[model samples]
Target: MRYGLTFLALSAALAALAVLAGGAALVLLWPAMSFGLVGAAYLARRPALLGKRPDGTQAAWALVLLGPYFLLTWATWRAERALGRADCANEVVPGLWVGRRPLGDELPAGVRLVVDMTAEFPAAAAVRRHPGYLCVPTLDGTGPEVERLRELIERLRGVDGVYLHCASGRGRSATLAIALLLERGLAADVDEVEAQLRQRRPGIQLNAAQRELLRRARARPGA
Candidate 1:
């Protein structure tokens, strides 16, 4: 009877964690992963739910279930660290005026082309007027907009370098750089990318229009 009750409690806890994790994904990413872990812990605790194990078999089953979680977490942490390190390296470029680490900066001279992410401001206007292309808002890591960005990058004619600028250079701006280099397999140094932004423009301050654009951009999944 005691064992049966423990199983029931574990089941309830797992259900609660699922709901909580789903809710958290709306606001943050990492916390949702934590909630996912509760379900795994429940499984590790209740081996019989899957199949009856012989005595002393629980240890093997526990390892099987928990091993993936540890590996995934380790891999994710390593990736984040690598990205952070890349941003740090970019910070040393003297001419680029960074609003924050790995974000917003001045356009370098040979960067005759610009790809502008849609957001309010003089910066957006500057990029639009500059001699390149315009790629509008896309959600985090998915959808038709992402495809459009790919097309734009591919279609670009001769240009020394492309400078992508957005207001405040946070979500959509930084996300685009990450996707191009990391997800889409484009090769561009982050520091060199920062140099292409126009330092003379009034800092990385975003007006009301840019803020609204970002809110909409973030509303997309996985952002």
Candidate 2:
């Protein structure tokens, strides 16, 4: 599931279990596996799968996740909308969009680029087919890497449409979208743009780290 505090807490507790059990962590393997699969869905990697496919970890792991993991994502997104949280996706600007991860191949009509911020999922088949995909593998509840984001922003300088996505479209995706706006000089004030974004998509939110990164983008250009 979501990383930040939850991932860290669970990991800490699991470490305690191992220590008290004299390293018999396997005693908790079943529950550990469950938690790990959920974490993978949110932030882990099958990097080779993103390769043209390092992530060649041979096991039923990929099978389980790509199959059931996706179903779980579907249910989660549905529930997110039902609870007045984040929806599947939203177009914030005419040519720029932000939202949760796309579970399928076909993107919104003209979205030629898929900027996946999470670590695990591969670009959809269609995205790979057309070679219009980029994965910048950031963990949930964190900010993305700096240099890659700059390069991608430059690449998107005049593109007709782009879709920026993270796990829930709430934090990471919105943060990046705000940076893009600031970089392109479309919006000068961070708070104002964020307000506009929230109006368009009520569930849009940026975590503290995400907001700090955005602030850095303004305080230091091309950073």
Candidate 3:
């Protein structure tokens, strides 16, 4: 029964693809595809409900589909690990680290200040236990708030070691790291700051608005 359900689901998916290719509207095939998916999920959860067993050929087709399913799952797992490596934290400068939220309680010694740029506080109870955890909620955009962010960073920089992060450590955190580098005169320009960051954190990303904000902030008098 499970094998039969798998075949039906696969067939429905193929039919949906064919309909899409034929220039038919998706609404025409969505019901069939959805019904097949629901049926398969139901059978998977309660295999005994079907009572009857599948023949050998039906079982074989099911195994064939199952093989790709398992392979795809493994590929997804590996890809996630690779992507995690790309986003792992790295020291942007001496005593300064940036990346996605760090795991475990074993942060490096001297990391006394943790600046969280995420819109919401981190869910980890362990993270909240840090001695100096500061949350500065912001998004990736240009606004008067950039000046306040600079001020926040300035206060945090007085500590010996600072760790900066956001939800993904890609947009808002990277933007602030660049801003910090500019404020400190450690980087001559946005391009230079970005180059340094990318060298240390391979997947660091900054949106157009963040880049423009950095430029405008850097150009302001006494910035």
Per-residue CA lDDT of candidate 2, range 1-223, in tens? 3562364456456656766776556455444444454554445422233221312122355545344434555576557656754556789999788987665643687888777775444555555454567767665566655655667667877887788887678787888888888887877677888998998888777777778767765665654
Q: At residue 132, give the lDDT of candidate 1.
A: 47
Model 2 worst lDDT window (10 residues): 49-58
Ranking by lDDT: 2, 3, 1
Report the lDDT of model 3 for residue 190.
Answer: 82
Q: Per-residue lDDT of 75-182 in model 1, one digit per residue for the tens?
A: 654475466432321221232222221122345554554554421121323434455444443221112243454555455423235554433344445444433432
TM-score of each: 0.31, 0.69, 0.57
- Cα RMSDs of all predictions? 19.7, 5.6, 15.6
Instruction: TM-score winner between 1 and 3, please give it.
Output: 3
Q: Given candidate 2, what's the lDDT at residue 75?
A: 76
Query: Cα lDDT of model 1 overall?
Result: 0.37
lDDT of 3 by residue, 1-223 (tens): 4434764776587666768776655443544543454356344533222221221011333334344433443465456646655644678899888876565453566788777654322324566667677766443222225567657666855466888876556677788788878777897888888888989988776767678777766666565
By TM-score, the best candidate is: 2
Clash number by candidate, in order: 7, 2, 0
Off by over 4 Å in 2: 1-5, 12-27, 33-87, 221-223
- After superposing candidate 3, which stretches have Cα over 4 Å from the reference? 1-83, 140-144, 221-223
